[model samples]
Target chain A: MTDFKVKGKVWLITDNNGELINDIDTDQIFHNQFLHITEISEMGEHTFGNLEGWENFPEKCNPGDIVFAGSNFGAGSSRQQAVDCFEALGIKAIVAESYGAIYKRNAINSGFPILIFQQINNFVKDDAIKNLDEIEIDFLAGELKNISSGKIFKINPFSKVQKDIMEKGSLLTI
Target chain B: MPGKTVIEKIFTNHSKEDISPGKIVWIDLDVVTARDFGGPNVVKNFHKNYEGQSVFDQSKVFFTFDLTVPPKTIQYANNQMICRKFAKEKGVKVFDIDKGIGTHTLIENGLVPSGSIVVGTDSHMNILGAVNSFGQGMGDVDIAFGFRYGRTWFEVPETVKVKIKGNSSYDYSAKDLVIKALSILRTDKILGKAVEFYGDPIEKLDLPERITFLSMITEMGGIVGFIPFNNNTENEIKKMSGLDNIVPEIKADGDASYSEIIDLDISDIESMVSAPPYPHNGMKVSDLEKVNVDFGFVGSCTNGRIEDILKVWTILKGKKIKEGVQLSIVPATIEVYKQAFEKGILKDLLDAGAIIANPGCGGCAQGHIGMTGKGEVMVSTGNRNFPGKQGDGFNYLTSPEVVAFSVLNGFISDREF
Candidate 1:
């Protein structure tokens, strides 16, 4: 079990189909500890497999790194398994414009952090950007700062308890 | 401050001092329930973290294994085993195996007291409020905490008083009333709020009918929907529980504060329908033109009571369901199923071409039998009609009468008394 830290170049995905299947390369974000995005798709076996692809994409990826995706991500299935699989893969937080209600609750209850951001799809580049550098998350301030690119993004702040759970690790620990 | 509805009175009376919505109240938990699906995780977490002896009063804690029993997966089986072990080790006496009913139903028929605050690990636990209890669904962590400490915090909710007045024809029932309410409130209006049903008409409903009404509060995003305990409630408790001394704390003085109130006259209510994709998209039965249904179901925690079964039976007594429409019925509990069997309601439904299944929430969640096909339209009495909820198809919600009549006429029909 490795602790996750965001300390590499950023790679943002802007595909409407935010699936990390063979077509989309997560190598940049996974290898460099960067952020990525794509549109939400229906949750299915194929999608579950694609999520597992994160294992090969990131170098030292662990649960706790933030993922910035597009609107309506995680929009299907009341099954907690989908969210659990992501947690198992070491993706700590998911920042999207919107989420399906059931998925949001499941993510929260499972101790995964989710943040909603507006125009997030347009803020980062679609392709991999080297030297994108480390991003600092000031959870209380609800601000994300990119050290290399000198870019900053605003994220919706979570409640104090929610922040504690995210920072201290899973609800199992809390 | 006077002349408040019964629900309003009770909520205000029991509310923690200076507490309001969006803020945690930290009130005493009168009851805490858990089941197989999430119960093991909660107990495991509790044992691992808390070294205290029993936190809450043992008499107030309830546990059951309904959802994951006959375990759906190996993981589910393992979880149930852990839960059973924990329950035994913790000295919790209410653990029931195959004979156990669903948690909400069990609580209703067992130990839940009126005017008490209740929390459960399952989302549908809110359904327990039909007996005038205030219930809410909490995450596993909160539930574990409650297990470790007899009390938990809450953000006292503003009350939404719904007064249902007037008598309804045989075709309309409380299920229709709630379906209409859900259609009007959508899914967001009642989030984290309490809905109280009152009026002389509401008093006339039986326990099962009232349970059907209260069970759908979650559909409107409410924490719970309740009615003040009355003689009817006491009598039902006596009959079901065989306990004569269970007196419920009904409500507080009438002069209480309420956030909002809505009056509904059911005398003029006709058979109603909630179309696919949303429960709030409601229309009159007469307005359902060009809408064809391939499947029809009359069961769920919301509409699976004996009274609901009788209503469906009354509609299908001398009629047969339309050709090409697959109809199914599932009673909510074993006791209800036995009651229907003894009363010949199940035979009537079965003889009329309806498939009878065991008493549980099966097809309602689209997990078990009666899954709809692509583009198939189903008329159901279950709560919630979100897209692909009853399978990858369209589902419309309505009263049991409407479901029965639609099964008979091959299309949505107004229930004839």
Candidate 2:
């Protein structure tokens, strides 16, 4: 992909079998117990806290790190805290095969970047994508390049409204 | 114009400009609602962002205290207090802690008629689709904006048409249909898309059954699941609110364009349960034969209506559940509670050894009764069976009949057992 803009280290959300965990719901991202905490900064510490085998996501995630996940990544609950948790972590973007309806809307409205990487499974099997691998993304083209491995994968591009909403910075401004 | 789906019609009605799926458009809202769970956060955002500005319309705004009514924790108490204060200042209405679920309250109160657009804080607000209305759940930030402007931006979503075919047997209920559908369709088929259900069997579904079935679209990763308006819908509205002007404004064209189409038959559908860890993990009740149940809950937005309660009573009448199984019966709304009390349904359930709780979202939020202890297993009528949804224990979702039967047997069972 030419004119690569956003770049970051890859962080994969996989199960113990190293297979991508699909249907990673909002409850897994942010548990209901922490709903009382209103401060955005505090939400990061609890990111992925409810998820099995990923309780340490908050402690391990670094700024400018991009996350990859399986389909329906943000399933369940419209709790904005799910999206805010990633924003608090300073994550560059999340690429999943699909997303929950309201969760996708929340991320787009908050100006948090999210993309759909349809064939992430095949790439993971080929060893072309790995955790901590450097990568660059072309948002408009929906192209993701493995900078370290010299491989690229096709991704669904943002819709017109999604781009406008992200560029305008939140739904209210749009 | 080529034919248009019901969603297209609804979106076009809310928006003045020409609209299409995937197109960004600002739409007017018919109503804005928030529950205790998210109302406080909306108030906080309103003060932080739209301070000194009047809400777009006070009459259309409502605060429903159903998520954690009576304030089990100090945090929830303070949150409810904030919502009450903000609602009073804005001259809006607060349904209070005794109102049960906010969405069900709106339905019971006739606030949401067909074709109406409703925005709320509860993610399952799309449950409104059962009545042919367009309902969606958003976060506090979105609700705060909606409160200020009485409008919000939406990407018109394409529709998936699911045709429900065949008749159900005596033992099977709408909950069985929903779990069965979730198993076949899973999350991939409907994610971020609207679903239109039309077929022979669907027309026979009453409002309560429709609510039981439609409430699950969220679990299946769908934006909304709609059943076209029928005589039962009108009859329920009249019976519930004494209003007859509830006919929706639009219907899908005969030749509407659809992203995908599916047909699901229920003739062979049987009692099933969505086992622990996921809502869509459906397996036959026979498959869970020997699994002992420590607790049983027979209510929620999914199956807490009077009709469902009637089903529970029919199954448990004159028969006590297992001596050790702790059974809790929580109705969906205050109106439902009143109906049950007036009709002696609650008395029968209580006589059957059920500990009746106040009308609200029980255990679904871990807010009220039905939350399980570690190693405890609960068979619930609620839609979700998430890991920590009802408690530390495993929550298996099933029909009211099945839950009632399980409580009687002290283990998961079908009606015949």
Candidate 3:
């Protein structure tokens, strides 16, 4: 197994109080209104369009940025657009407390990175990212380190299949 | 050896090995399904990945033109065309245009059987567990792979054994029972879990009633819901499929281990509703009487069966909808529509001023017809009530009877037996 490393700006997905939002369904991640938009390149602008705090994510987001979310990150509806939007927005990886079963599979098959870490929401909630200059993630090592805060959070290791898919591009390719 | 849950037995049966929760198995699929929105995506993946590869078994693939049936827009039409072309080229049966929904069409045509491991590209495939089959939703990419390889991977989920007692009245439907289950289980509690319904309460429900009950299991965060195999279940399967006899029943061991046991009573569940924003926000209908309903919908894969529509037709036989209230009746598939139409049930609904829609997943996912405008509130029989799910409006989930009564009263109203 190889440890995948990524360093990127941290994007916190939370409410105004900075508490992580739970049960973020796929429609909230990417509204069904844009289902007509087939081209993924045009999907970034609609990412989080229905979500309150992240409506302007298209212009505000940068490629390779990491997103932090609460439990059931991609719950409800098996629309691939939810994970596809993140990939379109160039999201390097999504570290949530948990994910919907279908979303987890869609992410893995698409070779999108999704990591799980209990208490990840606590670290990202309530201005936890204010002091962090950069977030570094080591998939195999199961360590999430904040450069500025010098804080290290332990993430759960991925299953063999998950790690293999992420490395092999997609399940089809594998 | 100890007994196994229905899901465990399924995995073991397919792999010919002992299987348990937390185990990953590459089980061969008994049936693979895809609908309009997901079908186009699967077609895209099929072409991209398996250009020269022949389908594993074309007859095993099921494609239905739902979500955008009748072609709501040009893009949707093109997508449906893609699915149609794929089905034609691969010799897969396509339930093209107004076939109701995929699962309904599949079931109504008798394509599925007990003990089968069914997977679809849409999440609502969990509804198939009503017949003791293990039905789960997969993404388009995985479904495409299943079409090529006739196998897909699954991490066997833990079993949540639910035992139900008490008999339900006419007004208090299986929909209420499911909504009550959602209230108790919550959306995240049953994640990646297979829910097995047991006891007399489950045994009493008919096939249509069972479909309506298990259809919303996904909304409760469950991967699938089962009512085990019984003679009644087999008879219902036979009636729908026109099959004289099914292979055999697949029953769990008497000592099957369950991760959790929930005791639910059917008599205790009233006409419950899931308020706006989430399906878990369930409350009894009497508490929501103050909320005026602008529209009412009585169809979807969840509640669009013949029995559900007949219930609505029974109530609205000699009545008209309240002034200014719009009620739309959507059947699950062409067969359901034809049955209802032949029996004059559709006429009764139409006479009651209901706007009968084409057989499809209209308004269930916020597209096609029956969408609500800003600030509009609708009492619908569809699954899920997420914001912007059916346009900028508030949605309350309920049974067909409550929807009919709400249409007559122009507000969320409870029904009497």
Candidate 4:
């Protein structure tokens, strides 16, 4: 398999202080009250509707933008809508300090990308993000680079199974 | 080498491969479940992606219409029809309109026997851990794969051991015990890990209480909660699931390695309630006696069993809910509903001005019938108190006894009687 790099403009799923919020549950990602709308293509319009600071995310975000988050992102409920919303928006990847177990699997199985970098919080702390324009992730090189700051951080490589799943584009494909 | 926990053992046995925490392994699923919201999506993917391939085993795959039973709208009705059409064509087990909550329906019909490794599209599928099954929630896409090929991959979870060591003479319910446990462990501590509850107090709990305990672990961000299978659990499983001669028990070794071991004394616990906004935001009920409540709810998969209802009736019988409080009671399943009705539990609740909703997810799923209004304060027996979990209101998580008392008094109660 070839090395995969996710390079895109960064979007913060954070609080007012710019600290990445912990436990951003699925209900906040995509509210369950709108679950009756079954079509994934139409889901992007309502992404982050219930969550504060990101209610207008669909209007602000561009396709291929990468989302940065804190610990336990997508924590509650197993609504694939949480993932499908991102897929519908064409979000390139999600880089989080941690994730809910089911969301990790769902993202991978849906052929979406989510990476774990433990030190991500250090780089995106309160107001440090205003200077950041873009980020680049090279899994094979095991590094994340800030385009504006030119500061690079190391990330753990995927396990054999994860690498295989990413290569195959989905778990079912593997 | 240390002996494996029940989760590890199940994975090892099913995959026919050595498995450890953090290592991903593939295993054929014994059962797969999807509720109303995810069922239609699974059906769509199976048809559009799999080229109309048949499921691995029709009987093992099932869908239940719990979230929007009886179809509250055209969209929901259409979703149910899509799932129903798929089930009809594929010959799979499909429980529709008023079959009860999905997990309760499965348990009531003897589908989830001991020693089974199960997966469902809904997060609360972890409730099956009470039956000693290796049950975990997964995304509907993975469940779709399980439906198509009967196999899925999982990373073996690290185990957290909890041992209960005391008895309670107070009006404490299993909900209180789990809320207190969540308060101690917190959500981050147990995220993605399997929690195994054991010891004398666990052994003393009946089937309903055991299920109640397992159901609340989801609120802690845990993957699954387990009570080791013993003769008592086996007998209860036989009695409730109607499966006699259960398989031999699966237990952790005496030297089983756990990431953390929590020792809890039930007698040290008082009636606990979770404050608004989070399930782990717990405090002693006595500390919040001045808080007024506008609504009271006494049902959900978490605490809607016969035993839980009895806990409420023990206090609320021959008493009226406060004039200003609106109380709703929903039993978990049709069988539980029937049992409650036969025992006159439903009559007692209705006579006390409780509005009994249909036997489904109801208020627990949120936005269903009988929702709490914005700025309204509710004391609920449901598992979660997350914002909008039961509508635009402030929710307090507590035992049914407390919920019953709060309804009668129109405030968060401190008194046992």
The candidate maximizing DockQ is 4
Expressed as tens digits, the lDDT of each residue in B257-279 for candidate 3 is 88989887657677889998989
- Candidates 2 and 3, the one with greater DockQ: 3
Worst 10 residues of 3 chain A by lDDT: A124-133
For all predicted structures, in order, the TM-scores are 0.74, 0.96, 0.95, 0.96
What is candidate 2's TM-score against the reference?
0.96
Q: Per-residue error at B129 for model 2, in Å?
A: 1.3
**Whole-structure CA lDDT of model 2:** 0.85
User: What CA root-mean-square deviation does each model show from the true structure?
Assistant: 7.9, 2.2, 2.1, 2.0
Give the better candidate number (1 or 4) by DockQ: 4
- What shift in Å separates residue B352 of candidate 4 from its native position after superposition? 0.9
- In model 2, what lDDT does residue B152 have? 90
Comparing only chain B with the true structure, the TM-scores of all models are 0.86, 0.97, 0.95, 0.96
Off by over 4 Å in 2: A1-4, B167-170
RMSD of 4: 2.0
- Candidate 1 interface RMS: 11.2
Candidate 4 lDDT score at position B207? 84
Model 4 misplaced regions, further than 4 Å = A1-3, A126-132, B165-169, B229-231, B264-267, B414-417
Show the lowest summed lDDT stretch of 10 residues, model 3 chain B.
B164-173
What is the Å distance of residue B147 in model 1 from its true position? 3.0
Query: Scoring each candidate complex against the real one, what DockQ results?
Result: 0.10, 0.62, 0.64, 0.66
Off-target runs (Cα >4 Å) in candidate 3 are A1-3, A125-133, B166-171, B229-231, B265-267
Candidate 4's TM-score reads: 0.96
Candidate 3 vs. truth: CA RMSD?
2.1
Q: What Cα-based lDDT does every candidate model obtain?
A: 0.62, 0.85, 0.82, 0.82
Residues B1-417 of candidate 1 have per-residue lDDT tens digits of 245545444555555555444554457777787766557657766787775567466776767655533555666667777767777777775455443346446554666656666777655666667666666666456677777776654545667777877766545677777766666665545555777777876666677777777777766656677776656777885666555666555663466566778776656556788886666677778777756778888877678777788888888876778889888887777777888889977677877899987666665543445668888888898776654456767888888888887778777776542
